[model samples]
Target: MSSNGTFTENEEAPTYAPSIPVPNVQELVREDPSQVPQRYVRDMEDRPKDTDMSHLSSLIPLIDFSLLLLGNKEELNKLDLACQDWGFFQVVNHGVAKEVLQKMKDVAAEFFELPLEEKNKNAMPSDDIQGYGHIYVISEEQILDWSDALMLAVHPSHYRKLKFWPKSPTGLQEIIEEYSNAIRKFGTELLESFSLIMGMEKEALLGLHKQLIQAYRVNYYPPCSKPDQVLGVSPHSDSSTITILMQDDDVCGLQIKHDDDWVPVNTIPDALVVKVGDVIEMWSNGKYKSIEHRAVVNDERARISYASFLYPHDEVEIEPLIDPKTEQLIYKKVKYGDYLRNSMKTKMEGKAHTHVAKVETLA
Candidate 1:
């Protein structure tokens, strides 16, 4: 990795084998919103069951970034509990300008609403994962998600493949680049807070990388007739250290597992949902957890979510930060690039890749 966070050619950047081309899911739903094709249908056991969270009577913990910035101890403790108990939290009043956020959302909506041909102009090449396409489709027999997406490399502007970005949606390119910086700043600030809570120097976590790498996964899930029969995204833990997701403002589709029950996460106006991912769990030596989460579709409306994934440089190793309380490390070191490639090559079935780093113990 270069000092600017770009993966240079000689660096061990993960290579993705070309995925078998999939049908344009958005187009399929327009012809008939009623039945999904067999490839898109999840098995009876895999389909979503009753996941309503009415029984839990609680939403994920909400943290006010304003208070954390003010160094309020009470709010800091809430941050600690949110990481430990849920491995997820909703952040409100995060300082990024509302207009920047709104514009990014508008462009994403406009881009997805374009005709399939116009959108496909930037179809993901047989050799790469970025551009107008979905990922994790390594096999023809894999169960498909009922979604269409335009994934992109948004940070380290020089590292981008501009040819894959949509040109029809004028300014779509500019807003994404601007918004990337805002999100990068936001993620870094939150990591500083997490470092304080972990009893480490504020730069401890930040010091792990030469430059942080960031990317965006903009998702579009069309309405389904049998909403319970297909997932918008499969159940899996994120491969990033922390992923900040801007949920669909009005629709609720994300669910995280808690206490043996799948709990639906409800968005509060503009609050962004923060997910603790596999790398965070590894570095924290499991003091904080990375939990499995999935997205589902509804019977009536399409859903759009813009998620920003934060990562250390590809060459950096995720060494477990020894927990003072435990006085030992539980996770062995794993290079980020290797872990990332493993997670992207196959279907997500939980935190499968993260387990590869756990130290073995014999009876």
Candidate 2:
């Protein structure tokens, strides 16, 4: 694969793109509410079970990253509790600059606001999933999310697809790369804390994910005329080891399933939401949790979000560190690359995830 003594990066995974183009929901929602398509509408059971969790929203965990970095053991304990109980928390005093956050948000808002044809300049290719498209659209008849996004591989520079990067909004590319670099160190330090909480060396988890993979998905959820009848995104858990989320500062839609209830996530100024994903759950031998979560739509305005997903190298094995004394080996060990590709295939076939069996303890 050498060209003039220079190596080129090929697509890392096989083709798992959607079978068809996703409709421009941002434009479609502008139609009258009575004529809204059945495709985006949801049955009663699938809609939110409750939206009155405003009071409980503030109950979600809030951790101060600076305190944790100062070797405050109590903050580490809180991180452990947040992982085990809520699977989601907001981090304040995080090292990322407010300017970086605002710039990323500004460029994203400007990108989605561009003309439809202009925005589709980076429409997702049928052979790949990294571009402006809906990642969950699997079939012709499958129900679709009320949102669209631009997905990109941000780290391991060689693996990046430059063509998928947007063209206009002059600073979009630079701002994205800047924000990506800004968060890289924080994500690494956060994982180190996980290792300490697991009673292992701070570098233990870091060692397991050399050449860590990071990707960003900038999402745009348009206002729906019949908001309660549709969903912004389905209730699915992320596959990343950990996801650092930049939620909409002006609107709220992200919700997590907790305590047999769907609780709204209240936004905190200058804080980012950190989520425990399936990879962390398996790696911890189920010590941590990856709770199911989704996005809800509203009638008045659009909701925008940014998610930076971190993962282990492709060849690494997802072997759980079981407590030999109390817990039995549960999750099947598999290559990170294979597991990720298979999950994509399952989604392409419009199937519910059957992988990652429930991690359990021995009686």
Candidate 3:
């Protein structure tokens, strides 16, 4: 990784191998929408065509958290401003080793390249909750994403007993275990920092997530000859509390919604792109913005990336970022399950931020 934040832009990066076919838009529409559940279809249906690619002032926002983590209030405020405005940032010196990230990416690629039948065996049936393979319309009624992904729910109790993984990649579990621990540790530190930034107790948010749910998604984007014709993943905010992504150093296709256009974001070699998810935004009473982003499959090559979601325990009470004395609506209190179900049903395109009526929770 370069010491300078900006790298000499590689104008001609090559794509990856073994083309994965993408169905045309008509074909996708013809398929049952229930097969591709995502949260936010109602809002998306109302959005204009121009909403997809509006241009933002800046394409990439980088935040160096070392200063802020050291208790520099000013630096932390500055960083928060960037996040609120830009929604995404490249973090450096945030603790995770570059080698660990590379190894994760390597294992992810190996997992995707295994024989299709083997990959299909782990596929998410419409009904199955846990295990190996991809889940089509896992959200509820969202459109199919151009990418194929495997999801795993691994908490401390189930960390060593992973049920879904490719056998061909002999050491996939070992590689993932190490990477997961590193990420979990890093996430804890970040959560503490976030708590401090919000003028709360250092362990304020961490304590709320007693059974913190951690999920890992291995995403594979096959080469698409027509890059502009379709998207790898639609523009949507993460439903989790935080999303930590490890992208391939070789191929670039991640984009975020800026101003109005979907601006391309180049992944800095060895650096992770961290985003504040909708859950955090809701908890913050909308103080923080959950930026919208999507994956664009490379027309020239196949791409592989790993995304780790740091979520709260299922029963955690999420409220607005207001003090009790204020009595103001900082945010409506909602159960995590309701939010998750709503998010899953809508297509991934910026659905997480859709403001739906709050559901009352029973004691």
Candidate 4:
């Protein structure tokens, strides 16, 4: 993938395929529980353990889209608090038809269910990060996640590479395109709402005519023999302005770091998870944090999620949009292209990369 986020096919195959064939975790767990590779195991310190949930009784806020459209004051207040305090929320009664959501889930499951060799046809090139493959795998000794992902650009349709898209899953392309269009429109509305919540004009932070770029990640977290030791995705905040996630209804693995504890985000029927990304934090001048979150694998069932990220055009320059009464500019102006290039060089673990963009202040 280029700095502009376009993917090009490289004829050469990657030289870094694992020495041992990567076992299909979904099938292997159903047959033999102990076949999990040592590389997939986590150290004792990184394992998941039973934690107290009683203190986390207050679930993340769920904002009704109808209320947002109606401009209800109370609902708008909730949206503000959710962004300012939690940086994550569930949007219920969202306009996307139930049929569209179901079809997206169905197609995603169907695509991942294909045989490993069949799925490899869409494998990403060694240099491109926008197809079926693992990401951020820098070394053989690094711990691997118990997941597989298919990533592709959805918006600015010209950036899409149809060859990486699955043709076997009947109607996959049509449904995904329809779904992507709907989400792109809805995501724009949400960004406008964010500006209003910040007491600015609807398009103050985000420009009036700025074109947003959308990318999709279809994540497949297969069942793991040692669920406690492996994570589906490592902890990291998104690099986009906002991310809308369509999670598997029957699975529960998405967790958010809250006040030193990892709390599970319960799935709300027909609701999409809205996340504040690093760009938003910079835009807000550090007033709202980009939450740290991760996904864990299930012991018996596989998990799937589709995340749509809304980003600014590559040429856009990002600068802190500070509100005189509340915020002071904390980050310097930088081009989106430069930021992305610098970010790609670092590991996606925590908010360290975001911190790099911050301006140091002296006492």
lDDT string for model 1 (115-214, tens) is 9999999998777788888788888899999898888876555557778888979998888888888889989999988888988887778777555778
Alpha carbon lDDT of each predicted model: 0.83, 0.81, 0.65, 0.77
Q: Model 3 misses residue 68 by how many Å?
A: 3.1
Candidate 1 lDDT:
0.83
Residue-pair clashes per prediction, in order, are 0, 0, 26, 1
Give the higher-lDDT candidate: 3 or 4: 4
Pairs in clash, predicted candidate 4: 1-128
Off by over 4 Å in 1: 1-17, 55-57, 323-328
Scored by TM-score, the top model is 1
Show where candidate 3 strays beyond 4 Å: 1-59, 129-133, 136-143, 159-161, 324-330, 357-363
lDDT of 4 at 99: 91
User: lDDT, candidate 2, residue 221?
Assistant: 94
Over the stretch 112-203, how does candidate 3's per-residue lDDT look in tens digits?
A: 76666676566553443344434434333444556667776655434322445555577887787789888888888888878887788988
Stretches of candidate 2 off by over 4 Å are: 1-19, 30-35, 323-325, 348-363
**Ten residues in sequence with the least summed lDDT for candidate 2:** 345-354
Give residue 341's error in model 1 in angstroms: 0.7
